[model samples]
Target chain A: MSTPVQAPEAGQATAPRRLGRGTLRFLLPPKVIAGFAVVGPMEGKGPMAGYMDTTLEDTYYGERCWERTESKMLKEAVQQAIARAGLSEQDVDVALTTDLLNQCVGSSFAMRSVQVPHVGIFCACAGFASGLALAASLVDGGFARAAVVGASSHHDAAERQYRFPTELGIQRPPTAQWTVTGAGAVVVTGGDAAGPMQITHATLGQVRDMGLKDPYDMGSAMVPAAAETLVRHLQETGRRVEDYDWVLTGDLGRVGSRILIDWLKERHGIDIDGRHSDCGAMMYDASEQDVHAGGSGLGASACVVSGYLFKAMGRGLVNRVLLIGTGSLHSPTTHFQGESIPVVAHAVCLERPGTR
Target chain B: MSTPVQAPEAGQATAPRRLGRGTLRFLLPPKVIAGFAVVGPMEGKGPMAGYMDTTLEDTYYGERCWERTESKMLKEAVQQAIARAGLSEQDVDVALTTDLLNQCVGSSFAMRSVQVPHVGIFCACAGFASGLALAASLVDGGFARAAVVGASSHHDAAERQYRFPTELGIQRPPTAQWTVTGAGAVVVTGGDAAGPMQITHATLGQVRDMGLKDPYDMGSAMVPAAAETLVRHLQETGRRVEDYDWVLTGDLGRVGSRILIDWLKERHGIDIDGRHSDCGAMMYDASEQDVHAGGSGLGASACVVSGYLFKAMGRGLVNRVLLIGTGSLHSPTTHFQGESIPVVAHAVCLERPGTR
Candidate 1:
């Protein structure tokens, strides 16, 4: 593959951290010092039960509204992450966060108490990975010493805002994935910090839309973006599928996950059969949880990586992991307006230090 | 004031770029190579008419829906800015954009055609400042050689989403500000690039809430945040108000602007009388436009800076400018839920290189 190059502007030097067009190879890898996840009662009953830091008895999580519940979960996750890292609120530099709610109020309200400088980012479900990549870059570049990156989604909040209200008892199609009622936060510190996981590389995705207007089947609409970013990351970094111990994708459920495998093989001749697994698919037991396809939302991948994967890494169960967070960028208004869903995916590589 | 310092991690050197808790002192300042603005007919008829790159005869701008119009305007702004920079789409590294829309669809849709890696940020109207700071840091840190940062807002679109439908034509209170139908894009390159304006410093703001719940009186809700960021920025950078030729704020309109001036003088003992101006207040003539307070939106400060302010700078009318983009972070849902408004403001310092 040819290297993506631009005409050098003025005194520009080849940045040591930038590997390709959109891929960043950090010279001083940022360490993920701590991770925390909070989920609802339903998610606590799922396969990811033991990995979660806190599980609420209900979706409301003691709050009056689902939105406030989301904000609380996000706040708890971030506070827990910082605490687990042996740092206080004043020790962190910034909080980069986002959620599925309108205007991303979940993050804004949550950060009101976290009290650090807040940078609200939006990539739909892919927000966690986007935040992670940006936070890692900031730490590696010395713009921040430590950053708390998080994302959250409440099932009831997503249902009412993006689809039918929970009280309406609307029937979702088989292709529809359940929005995970959870929040996850990761504390990323600079290279000097010792941690189990290090962020070594990142690849930002481009917006990809193929005119798919079926909002119920977000999986189908998002496959192209997921495959695009995954392929680009591998190609740009000159790495093969086998190089990674786990190729983890965000909330691309059953259909999207299968399609991604086929698309990557057909389009780029990449084989990722055993190494690839999806956070959405892993979130719930197909038969027991009534979630049709699986779990989805900004919180799905976030919870999986921050809760399950990081814990696994600490136990030496995994070393090299590539997390690709996928998002379908569509709102109810856009769907009503007959606009197709635009999708994006961002990839971040996490490795145990000295794994190579 | 005590210097903001954290316990340095293992093998960590004191980063030369961090000035205070949230302020960044860019070692190699990013240059603003080009800027482009597109405004609706009403805005074109206002005082900023001559500086705008494009003016639409109607709000639709030839599009069928208001949302599409916003997306179109954002796309045009980014394209025009890139063109003005004498670069192709391939020359730019990424597009950092956001708008006052549900899930930030305005930016996602616009970037679908821009074909660059997209980073969507949300801080309500303060998004332009957030994007600029992130883009500047990315460029200065060598992760990106050049980046395009932009923000957009449409009057009807924002009105319908955030408040009463425009078709209802509900009477707005005197404290309400007009949402500007406009979009602006700025091209920022690495320090090696030669340009008229240079971004030397940035301060990311924390979420500030004074328990103000009035959706109509957003100016009042946001004043605390504006004051907080401005004070923090000045204190962190060790610069006085007089150091800047102009201290420009985003969308604080008439009432909030007055509150800010009085509040700063009373609380912080800093006088910014003659050097201060609000983008929203400057956009329209008080007598002719009939906008009760003034303009307010993500596009308000964006259009003013990319259109009028940059042009003024190029012509040597101003040398040092401090841009504080402000946002009231409460959504219609949050307002409906009886939650108080959370506000944020990010400040960016721009100056002519030789003058500094």
Candidate 2:
């Protein structure tokens, strides 16, 4: 405790929790006490089906629009999280969330009825990790006692916005990623560990672009950005690949995850083979599900981390874990306008307190 | 100082800075050292054109795409801000930014090469104030030594993404506000006041929906949310209209600002008539410029406050100020699907630190 994670400067008493270039050491780590996931029919039938708190047979979820439906999915997940934690909506101090929709209306509309003070964030697919990192920071900084973080994406909605309308039944390439239809929410509280996992540190990523302009090749675009954050996190924390039992990415999907692993080995000489997994790749059986590349979206990582990873920790299947939420920042309009894709990835270390 | 703004409940020495039901009181206010604004061709001809840091004769700003132009506009603004603050990029510990584009590509891509650790936020037009509030909080919480907050909007890009392609020359309603093509950036730091103004307090608004679903009528949608935060800030801080020299709304425009004033008077019995003005209304001559409702977008408020008001304060022409940033939350898809528009507003108190 005396030495602390960050060393004090010549004039400072408590060192600013700056880890390396972009990583942050949360001296006061926040506990992840509760989480919930809701998925659409397609996602409900995926590999992580058993992990979902609820699966909808109706994609609309009784809403007229896919955007509103996505909002409902997020709202229900957060509400379920608070209820599962044995608290009322009033007890959650803040809500950090965003969706795939423009202006993040899904989150704002959801929060309208939920009524918690909101901090809206947008990071494409990386929203889950981004939101969690911010909420944890707020909690550690004593800004909030309890923070509810949520993210969501609906396939039909994303398809229309990013590409052609679903009614067109547009042919997709093998490199295309199917946006997952679902929502995930997690409750983070600043206090003694009251749950199976706690967020100990976070590395905020830099926007990275390697001239990958093809919107269909997003996995390739995000892979290096993911590597950047992971490497920065390990170097900053002075940890190795062996430090974490599992190194999970929100949604690097199948092709990207493999490329990322090989790239990490070649570039940084860090080989994370058996320990690595991607929420995108693990969420679905690509061939069986007809999801060409793999799953990808804000909901993909949110569902995997909040539902699968949290439950796994609770069940003692996994203890120490590193969750890297990756996002590919591009739009069809921008793509048409000849812009290269920019990607970002955020990494947070999670652990079962006693095990760590 | 002993009798802190937030009265402790029972067993606390310093209150946690929670005021009334929703507002936050900063025990250590953060200083606003420098701010810069860059605007496009149309905006360069506006009323406050003389106040901008940089203005472009070409709306494209030499970029092939509007999104990239907007990003460049934001980058230049931040660079100008750091220069004006007598600091370098290395002095900025963190960058907070957002834009109207999907995934906030304008900001993410702009930040890709800026090399600053980033926090990507999305609250539509309210991004300037929202980003600054969070940056101030990070500085006050010791997460950042100095934080740079940036936001931007491009008229052509927004039109295509939100409605139609600019080539279509879409017919517009009188209620529709023109999207100001511009960017703004502010440098916030902890420690002594670097200039005339400091952020003293902030009230994060809850999402409010009044069932108005038209995308063009954003100003009307956001008016109530703006009023709510203003009233809450006043009641929580136990301050009256006389407490601040001016209370400004981000981009409520003409119609919305008038509605807000009347609503505050009728609903809360608080009349702030002569002392109030909106950045939207002040940005352009509505009738003469053919900007029907008035100027709007992330650039509207950002350009007015950071470029115009910040300079005014430094010149000792103004003292106390309250900036209420308003955002309308709705998508064209959601609107067509019959969902109501949701809105949010954030209020931050600014003042001359020593005088206060």
Candidate 3:
């Protein structure tokens, strides 16, 4: 969509300016040339009983007992993906990686260890999908031969940044999801391949401000934006909500997922039915895992790109997937703007070979 | 370059591997597609003095203060460059931007304000040139039609993060130069244009650990890397130091500049003669300005891309220009290792239409 233009000056202070309609055109389309997933042994560890099941707790030795460092996980994931693609570092024209951290430390530090030139990206949870979209655009524009998109999360590290120490008796929110400590990587190139999935299109949602105050409660904060972007993607691509084998939203826990579904149906007349799934929910067995919700930015990103999604592709259980990432655009300034929190989102459509 | 591999027994420990020469062949040559430079208001009216001079005191805010936030500066610079290239935001398939901040907050935050999907890059002072190199590779590989590259810095914000406030009487070495608080942006695309300059090739230098420990003193810390990259570019590209009408290093204050010249002559067997210059030196009056060295990452980036280099192009003072950016790759881990500092550099060659 083209950016709206400001209305012509009427020279009247009392009249409001009319908003111009934005233009929509495809400059680049999304496509997946390769994919990779990596998991660390430490990520599977469970938290202490009775502690907030949704948050990772720091243990002795300055490390989180329940989660691994996202940077380490991401490096492994990206390396494996690169190796699997039978492409050397030099074959990668660009790299887009992101994670939940103060400044995408995971992506930045990971790039340092790789030989390929890279750039770090961040859009909160939506960052991974956005990275994929951007990478696909580069490939479509003929700017990159192969690009890698990766994301990771470390539960222990993220908890400390969002909440108090484990010792602090903070009330747990039902909507809160435990961050899965994992990483996922994907390699995208031009031309046809044996891979089952290909990206068809992508759409980025405008930043929307909806008053969500708590930084830790991201599910509630990002749901609205997620819905907005998903609808926009379907609209822009002329696709229907039921066209995909599965519709996935990154990191939206049970509560946020419900909210998103309801909003989509009510506002956009799009009912996703049971085909809609949440990556966070699928990352772990909630009943056995004790996670109230499922996961966070890194968790959702890693799980969706690596876990069931890719596995399904391999087994041919799913032919097409629509992946949407939601992000909270909260900053010190936006926080100071009162209780409202702003959010951004992006969506990418992937189709299996031989699928219409 | 291809990564070196050594066969070893299953039980044998492997030694550190070096990059193989064959790997270098994969990198496509870089070309300059579009460039822009802007000089912020500089009038000795703010908190400090020595306005417009590269040699201002480390704490001088007046002469070098950027009128807008670092984020705004990057966005505007990038927007203008893309517009000047007669391309819309969608034309940029990949966007790369960098800064000197620890977290790359400037680039990250600035990207949030733009409609273009982008990734944040970090290479310290060498970021500007490195960005160009990456952009060119993307274009050459046919992954993107055009890419946007930008770098920005803010003295007030950076100072607080690096050391004690100016109020603290911290001793500084003579080799230190003040960082310029500004930004510069360029748009690089494929296809021929009426512009006089074209990017020829770009080369990146290895990150060298020079064992320099002082972060406050960047000039001395970055000279070796700059010299190494410059020499390597000349050797690899089969271009003599005198081939270009001008050879500009982003920012190597007075002291570092002298050291660089001496080092180049001693190690590379090439003397640039009077053709060599530094953007830091050109930003302001050297002696009168309090900046012992001219500027660091931001200063050099802003001054060259915006102030002097672009002006030179406009005035037709020089048809061909070779710009080199030198960066210190220092981290907390290196500090613990008792390593002084490591530096990495990148070089970009630009030529007028008829020169090459």
Best model number under TM-score: 1
lDDT of candidate 2 over B239-286, digit per residue (tens) = 887777889998888888889889999999988898898888888876
Residue-by-residue lDDT tens digits, candidate 3, B175-276: 777766666777776634445445656666555555567766667777877887777666665678767877788777677788888887887777875878
Poorly placed runs, candidate 2 (over 4 Å): A1-15, B1-15, B20-22, B165-171
lDDT (Cα, tens digit) per residue for candidate 3, span A246-317: 788887878788888888889878887687887777666666776677767665665466544665566666
In CAPRI terms, model 3 is classed as incorrect
Better of 2 and 3 by lDDT: 2
lDDT score of model 1? 0.88
Q: How far off is residue A67 in model 2, in Å?
A: 2.2
Q: Give model 1 RMSD, 1 decimal.
A: 5.4
Which candidate number has the best DockQ?
1
Candidate 2 docking category? medium
Model 2 residue pairs with clashes:
none
Model 2 chain A poorest ten-residue lDDT run: A1-10
Residue-level lDDT tens digits of model 1 in A1-356 = 11112222232233377767778877778999999999999999989999999999878878899999999999999999999999998888888999999999989999989878999999998889989999988888778889999999999999999998899999889999999999999999987778888898999999999999998899888989888888888888888878898889888898888888888889888888888888988889888989998889988988998899889878877888999999999889989998999999999998877676
lDDT tens digits, residues A173-284, model 2?
A: 8888889999999999874547777887788887888999988878888998899899888988888888888889878778888899999999999989999988887778
What TM-score number comes out for model 3?
0.73
